[model samples]
Target: MKTIISTKYIKNTVLAAAALFAVSATAQDADDTSSPFSLSGSIDTYFRTALTTSDADGTYAPEGASTSFANQTGFALGMANLIGTYEAGDTGVVVDLVFGPRGTEATFENDVLNGIINQAYAYWNVSDKTTLTVGRFNTFLGYEVIAPAANFNYSVSYLFSNGPFSHLGVKADFELSDDVSLMLGVMNPWDTNDISLTGEYSLGAQLGLYDQFFNFYYDSGRNGGLGFEVDYTGGFDLSDSFFLGINAAYNTNSETETGFYGAALYPQITASEDFAIGLRGEYFAYTADGFDDVPVIGLTLTGSYSKENLIIKPEIRLDSWGNDFEPFTDNDLAPSSSLATFAIAAIYSFD
Candidate 1:
């Protein structure tokens, strides 16, 4: 087989860090050859159709960079993931792998792929209330995760799509109390999984509060000299079967002086043990260097049905904006400033 390995940012950093960590750990670590390990993951597929006739594929306008999960006109494979975790004493390791268009496109930073690794990290429990970790890992900025099985809606929000998906670096997590904790780290530049080859490094931190019925998480980071962002997320359980979640974010770049601010609300109701419904209402706007602020509103409704380890999600979404922007659809067919789409997805998970 033919293969290529690029000297991208993250690859070099990951290799050097992993080697150093291994050497330091091996000297003081005790063997746990008898310890147990486990494997688990999920597979997902979907069909989507845009309601607009502006494009042959009925592709929705304003679906921009983030809604590509179900952009295909017909049946499409979303992703296949496999996760392996092993823990023995104070040391642990995790390896997550994924494949599919959504998987590749989302993390193809620097246009490099090696076994489609989503996260490969190792950690040591410094103490009962503290831990230190290194390698690639998911970001703590958003309420929605990279896994489809974990999200109520199949389509991703603009905040999640546009924000950093993962980080490559070292971090320390501290549990301060029963309801509060803190995470601090230094990492590669924002939105890039590998090192950026630049000497500049980003700083990251997350403060979290988790209680019985309410949870709040806030994340902030500066992308070296380029920009900075703040993301806040909160969740509340109003009743046994009803819940609400909110997310807001603001990001600004130093060079351009442009900024983006957005907010989203997620409300869900459980109709039964096997059926549920949810809605997401969101508003997003951006200010450019020379142009006035432009904004849009999006609404999404989704239903989920579960049977054993299999789950099916059906969703419909609409987006509306002002005439200050170009018509959402291609060829300017949908000049009315709105577009719509519907999609259905099936997911199966196992251990």
Candidate 2:
């Protein structure tokens, strides 16, 4: 049978494959060391095939239904952090510099400059219970995150990272107890330009419990707006060799124009020390005053196997969005009512 493919998916697949290959080559030339100046990286690649249909196309069939061969891929590379000691070890200073290709860069036109520096930050350990960080850093919110497998759910939930990438400012984290902590910071809000907006700023705080089994974050900006997020995670052991877990989050912001909020539930079963299976379901919605609200719903089934130096994952996903947003069409404008997509992906990690 013949298969159809979308140009966008094809391009993404090729890029992902290239990133994976680069990571593999680099890892083979590296050595593991406990020295402060260490290096580590991982590569991910996947082929996404979709079967699309519309009423205008008559009977629903797989023929000519966009087959994305090797569509989505990427990689991440990071270096060992330096923790500087001061005053007879009474205070410690930590610095981290990280960069990566593919997803890390805003654009991937030329391979040479595609890997831009994504993170460069410093931290000061004020005490066992308090620490301060400055410079560019990832936001501390949500139960699921950009990190692979750290979240039971596959893909990204609207509540987890769709809003902003990083915050450039100062932050303080304080531990209230073994299971509770708090974080507060001030920075430019969302996608604001590096320069301050009329001396405007965004203030944020997070309350976390038990390594983030539950957490809440709030950000208030000078522009008469507020953003909030809540996350939760829980797991139970079914037997000696099997366990199940769930993760979920919700986010909302009041800028009054196209704000995002969503939730996800994942049920995972561990088959062994290095293998697992899971199902993920999520719903996300974006609302704006002058436009129709856009809602996206998706489901994914995933499986993985891993060992000392190799890890592999396979997943199938389906997504549908409300009419307000279009999907894969010539028009770049958001749709008005509905769109749907199906995809399959795989990844391999080595060190």
Candidate 3:
């Protein structure tokens, strides 16, 4: 009787697994039908280490320092995006629903998933060269973005996040030629949850042109003034790989005017098909109108090797803000002309 019971339990487990596999296969086949819905999303993770030092022993202190010498580790899981597209001949509609982690939050209440509708919008393809989109959507402003591999610089730059993350309004996109495209939109100036300010709205425009080797973008928001950025990526056969990017923007508010700028350069040498070494350098500066025009600069040097989907990166960085800014007085760290940090990271991607 005991032997018979054990065999029955094993048989039930196998039957359950078979049932799940059949259901998954059926769902996949259903997706292959000419239905109007699709699902796609990506996940990204990174670890960072930040360090600071002062010229005087008591001048500066780290805000959130780890006790271990190892760099701080952070993990994030993004919600899988569900996209729906309906086409009734040439005229069609498309909608996107985006959900994901709300950054490095400590609790579930603050996660992006709490906002059920990350993105809800509609679009119409008026013609082969024109499209109109209305609702809440991501902005097309800078070169770097929330996407991981799309950016060579590890962390978010001051200009990228300071501009605009999303817009709630209407936008028109036109493809002028093979190499040129333009986008014009008017938005609520803030997130979807915020009410529009009286007599205040934000208008933005962007123009882009390039062939991958070189690209240029010009964008401006009513309140953020105008910004111009350019990127260049090209290299000779086996000599060297290089990339150079720069951006500048100026803004004026009722109380003050500010200027922001950034530049970065990366050069790599591929010693073998699976082995490479690279160096990255970046700088940022900010100046305020009425206050002392103090500037801040940050730099990073990295060495990386990649094999298929695996990547290993080791980096060192330094940050410094001009004397115009006040320093922290209560920590063991000291504020100096510059602070340095060292970190190593590994990543793996699967399909």
Best by lDDT: 1
lDDT, model 1, position 277: 88
Off by over 4 Å in 3: 1-36, 51-119, 190-199, 211-240, 265-280, 303-313, 324-332, 345-351
- For candidate 1, lDDT tens digit of each residue in 2-109? 111111111112222222112122222266444346567789999987776466654454445234466677788888887777778888887777898767766773
Task: Write down the worst ten-residue block by lDDT for model 2.
Answer: 1-10
The sequence of per-residue lDDT tens digits that candidate 3 reaches over residues 88-141 is: 544444444334442221111222546544344566777888877777655455
Candidate 2 vs candidate 3, TM-score winner: 2
How does each model score on TM-score?
0.83, 0.65, 0.63
Total clashing pairs in model 3: 7
Order of quality (lDDT): 1, 2, 3
Residue 348 in model 2: shift from native, Å?
A: 5.2
**Candidate 1 backbone collisions, by pair:** 9-195, 10-194, 10-195
Q: What is the full ranking by TM-score, best candidate first?
A: 1, 2, 3
Give lDDT tens digits, candidate 2, residues 1-351.
111111111111111112222222221234752333322344444443333433333211123222112223333231211112111233323322223332442212222434343334556767888877666555454434333423333344444545454566778877788767777777776534244555556666765554445545555662467776565554444555454444566666677444656666655666667777777677777666777766777676777666654445566666566664544331233322333334333343332
Q: In terms of TM-score, how similar is model 2 to the real structure?
A: 0.65
